[model samples]
Target chain A: MTTQASVAPLDRAPAPETPFFFPSGDRPLYAVHHAPVAGRANAPVVVHCHSLGVEQVTCYRAEVLCARAAAAAGFPVLRYHARGHGDSAGDFADATLARLIEDALAAAREALRRSGATHVIWLGVRFGALVAASALPLGPPAAGLALWEPVQSPRDYFRAQLRGLLYSQVAEGRKPTETVDDLFARLDRDGAVDVHGYYLHRALADSVRDVTLARRLETWNGPTFLAQIEQRRSLAPAHAALAEALAARGAKVETMRVPEEPGWHMVANPAWTSPELVAATAEWLRAVA
Target chain B: MPWRESAADLDRARAERPIVVPSAFGGLVGIYTPAAPDVPSAGLCAVLLTRPRSHRNRMWVEGARRLAAQGFACFRFDYHGTGDSEGPTGPLDPNRPYRDDIVTVLRVLRAQLGGRRFVLCGACFDARTALSAFADEADAIAGLMFMAAPVVELDTLVRVDADRKDWGHLARSLRNPYNWKSLASAGRWRYMATVIGRVARRSLGAAPAGDPPLGAAFVEHFQALLRSRARALFLYGRDDAEYESFRIAERTAFAKLTPEQRARLEVEVWDGTVHGFLEMKRQRETFERALGWIAALHPARAAAPARTIPGDATPSAVAG
Candidate 1:
């Protein structure tokens, strides 16, 4: 079943939830394409890939809202889970670089087939950014890229995430019931590494460690934009350094600053959203990608 | 004092070749060092040590002192563009001759530390870049010591590779609800900002292009790094979630190494270390293991060529 996507044309209905089954003959990817109930066909496509962890569940509402906004803007938006999350087919343990890459390629193929649009605009949050960066380059390139807190270094990220978890839990007077090693070992044994209660698979974690999108971007040689927000300025030094490095290589960058709630990483607090960052990325993409 | 002992503290020491054996890569090799420039003689060695690896002010002699006291010279020198070296000072820009820096760092280490009996050591991702230097010349190194080497095979290592996703926007949105659309349009100077961001990524990206591996280290190379030499030591926190993220498979791989290969391998699991090995008392254990390594090498040192080994020679003169 070498199902390379060749989507059938359909009229864009207002607020339609288009059910899609994307198969690469390897794994079937389930997706729900969103469009305004009364939109015209050939609308701009927003391929929204979600984050990993409990946030994937918590922030799902926000993703829906973003998709709705894009749909209302005479643009069709689509969001899909990587093999293991939401209603996707495979187990999270199956999340590997190769599989995710295949899933991303299939998603892009389906996006092109459904929208009648030739180019795509990738909207990735967290791990999704890596997928889009890796997959988009395998084809005719994307129009633009909008990434939100894409995992920068899986090692540092997981470390920060774990430290954040410990701090928050400790602040709340939580005791270390089990050694952190046990938790990681449990994850490895079970194939799903748990981060702040979100169970992620071994393969997915491997994919994260293996996928280097900054290098991937260097290869893309197309319109690219990385929106970095300075909340507590935690990422300022690192991302700023990264920004400078990227700039020298020739990629559009938009940096935005906003107040941070210190414990955003500690606990998944959905209270902060930098409007400036969102605007900067949107505008950057409009101009470049 | 032959070299005007610049490191005021290491004025008294001597050089010793603790071990000389056939390198795993089919080459003859051994750890060598100079007698302490300042002290000149004192088998105690710790009080009279003098080899510094970085360009200058960026001296990484601390790792050696801390580890050597327990008994081995762990070379934590900074290569080009890092630490004290005048090479690449900017943000790991990736484009600025990193390979040259890699070559220079190793070449300098070889010139300075190889003849004096020193083991090559790396911390975190530094191991990856350092190993890449020897990827072609693995046979020349006396031995490799990776203190807290990242598990490049784990998925977490790839985060740096994802590029500048609008994390700021995500952070902003998570912090508060602010309409991001009209803002960029209203601001007349956005294009320049966008252009700058793009350029920075491109520049950083370019550095890693010729780099053997970018962002994350894979299982294959990581294993090679483990087996690159017969005397390879990997120290990491087994319990640290973040460290364990990628190390999960690597730890497993470490066990699969042969006994002879494994003899060359030492895996020290810090009960509770962050990615940086920030545990309270693990430093003591780490130092002890290093001392044990030095002791183990004593037998090998007896088998190597004997010279009128001056107890005063520091690591600098003998290493070269």
Candidate 2:
């Protein structure tokens, strides 16, 4: 005389994250992949692209949280450091735009091979989104692309970084011996300029400054998800325009306006969590799956 | 000639042996061994880099790789709660007893590399950790290389607080006609006067060097190391005024030591660099310098069997 509830199935626990290294070129890229806990139909292998420099460090915890969420939601997740960044075997001073794109493509292929998902999805933030966009033509066809606060123009991004360098100098009460023009001149003359700690080399800088995502994504008609941060209720006007443009390109587009505090800027705090963004992204990914 | 050249160089030397050691608190420690060819004949000192408190061991990877490439075996590891290491954050404290973690890593590293000579390298709060760990196990280790270490007096700290590099920008801004026009306002004039007085007071050493909370006696710790004939390197950036304060305090401490003890310590400053040596060129330079210093301090005793021991050598010769 056994009760009906006595033999109920136990809830499946999420897979423990595994850290390993796989090669893109001669260099090994440090990667952490989380296998899906429960089997789901038509699941996409999610590959995360991290932003560069300090952002990469600060955003790591958030990335881990999101990756765990995706894994828990029954999606196989892969997050990796780009060439010359993080635990990867390369020098950051030598990283170029083309190289980053190639790395993204390599990562996608590897993720697909490892996860055996029906299709691949690219989830990236800041400069990482640009890498994902540029790799589209080279990589396996993506099932979906999710960009969080993607930079519209590389030139604008570079300019903003320069402004930040200037601001740091000014705040220190030290007059920069070289002006912005002088720095550009040095880059032209010597093929690189030391801005703060980063070396803005000729090849990387030229390629980055010339990248216009709007132009590159014009014909890319995939399922696109754009998450923009907003302090108030309405969507940012620029993000709305980008969404409209993508939708016009024959892709099913979804927009989510997350809270201003997205929790990816503090390296010291390992407990920082972005609940709204994580919930939104997980829900959207699950529905699509 | 191409951007890929550097990457190629790094890749060639990028062999890392990733190992996880069990810690005391039922947790695992993540350690990465640099891809260095082991030369047991050279008796090269192995370096154990401590984590810089909040920073997750990523900052020291480049330095470790560079050292390994130059013949020294380098190991970088995360403490209990940081990086990929497993542990609850509750039990991990930088100020409290963490010497067990350091000793465990060293013991495991010694077993793996089969090297007796060891050097502890750390920066910032990590420097404090290295110093404390060395103090506890001075008999086991050879030397230390500390960067931007906290070893400052109240006066030096105040002086560092007053120093600034904004004079060039300030002069240019003041000369601008637009600024003059704006300065006509009473509020602007008052603000300018306040700033000017503050800067002037700071520069003139009028600020009080009030008693502030001090950590462990850093000078005393170094003196102990020096007395034992253990070599030390204190590195700082010129732009980091706080480390400059440390430089001044450390020099004052050195004045009280005998020549033999003084000879065991070396202080270096890198110009046009920040505390972390964040710039690529400077970072490389720092690594090279550390390698050179290590070579000088702990030369292959096997190579020159009859050579005079560093401890027994003339103080002037050691300093030179």
Candidate 3:
């Protein structure tokens, strides 16, 4: 007699991920929805908010893997490009912090409607985490927040970006004609500065310099998962401080120190996958679901 | 006039839609940007190949939009296992040209967009793939644009320590006292040693094993394409190593081409532009030059009306 397991396929194939466009204001935002395997009841959908500029391109594969893992674990996932980025309809110069937050809110609503879930989870990486947190107050209710190597301080982050611009300029064999102050001045005079290919608009630059995660998520009391991704075994000091602040606000915060290089910003092998990061995130999603 | 008037005009002119083409590996996701309604169509569709280690969003997105604005219907897609496409990503091998995916996309373009003539555009690894695919679909292709295409297979194996063209810049930096401080770091010392060791090994005739010379088949295919009715444009940055390799590796093959064949090909090297053309100034120049070249290919079709394809009427709109 054939056993039940032997007679049938060992596992059912996962549902195919879909690509579509949704309207955010007048422009369209591109998104890919990874459907969960059938037979789950009342699972929360996970909406991804991607990083800006080149980091978004570098972190793309890692995000895709994590989303698939979460979907396999019964969480419907939506990965999208914000306005002025990716396949989305807009120019980079048109993007602003306010516009990015608006797009995030739109994505959260779309995820809820598409998945037919009562609540959703915001999964953001780097600058995307800040966008999600800033949009928290003005959104449909979310069940949880999951961030991978979130940017705790926007001022420092933009400063580092400006430093990157300088590094690229040097690598191109150009003598440093402009200092950091000159770049700021250019942003003020021209209303934008070209960092690599993406133009950093004055409005977006000013907003990023003025905002921080602590200020944005001050009153948010909800379940949160923070992944501090680094090569070291210990959690970063900034991540530790952010976790403490969240816990003090009566939020159930679970922080994990992932001993892996931050593939989100580095030039790594194309086929590289962060297994530990995916497993930890899947476990967290299962617990929260 | 309002400052946003140009942007509004662009929005009104062009329309973008997402599409998925069924492939043997899986469904390949892509975005199609149609030519502006007001501008006359060139009756040509552009198929852009994806660069390795990066999705279509990096440079291809802007490149596609710019092409659309110039009255060419453009389609950019992810490979089977990349971007939003479905499949398990395999190891990164430069030699593994995704020729099957390119051919499949070309077939889908003919079916969905209703265009018989096409242009293939790619940079770096994708550029190499475009050349390989042109060998298979030369009859259907009208033009090709390759940015920094690597002609020598050995260039991928041997690591060139520094671009020889940047010697002036290096000497200038060495003369500066402030730049000398960087030499104090251990990392800088280690890098200097590595470069010296590599140079010494090369001088001693100690070449790396398994380094293959430029293949004769590759040269024959390129020469045949040049001999065809299709036009080709090659853009490269002066400082890029690929430019040097292409010059050295293809010198003999290029010399053998007939004058008429050479007339169909154009090669340009832009100053201060690196391999990726990261700066906006260089990128704009590249786009303008490419658009001009493609438009000159079929001047008679410039005033032709844009054809209405099935994609325009019924886009593959999946519920989200």
Please report, in order, the local distance difference test score of every candidate based on alpha carbons.
Answer: 0.46, 0.63, 0.70
Ten-residue segment with the worst summed lDDT in candidate 3 chain B?
Answer: B311-320
- Each model's Cα RMSD: 25.8, 8.4, 8.7
Which 10 consecutive residues of model 1 chain B have the lowest summed lDDT? B47-56
Q: Sort the predicted structures by DockQ, highest score first.
A: 3, 2, 1
Best by TM-score: 3
**Candidate 3, residues B261-292: lDDT per residue as tens digits?**
66766666665443665565555555556555
For candidate 1, what is the DockQ?
0.01
Candidate 1's chain A scores what TM-score?
A: 0.76
- Score candidate 1 by lDDT: 0.46
| Interface RMS deviation of candidate 3 | 6.1
Model 3 ranges off by over 4 Å: A1-13, A168-177, A260-273, B1-14, B51-59, B90-94, B154-212, B215-217, B220-224, B298-320
The collision pairs in model 2 are A173-B166, A174-B165, A174-B166
For residues B72-123, write the lDDT of model 1, one tens digit per residue.
4333322322211222123332112133444443454456554333344444
CAPRI tier of model 3: acceptable
Compute each candidate's TM-score over C-alphas: 0.41, 0.74, 0.84
Model 3 per-residue lDDT tens digits across residues A3-24? 1111111011257677788889
Range of the 10 consecutive residues with the lowest summed lDDT in candidate 2 chain A: A1-10
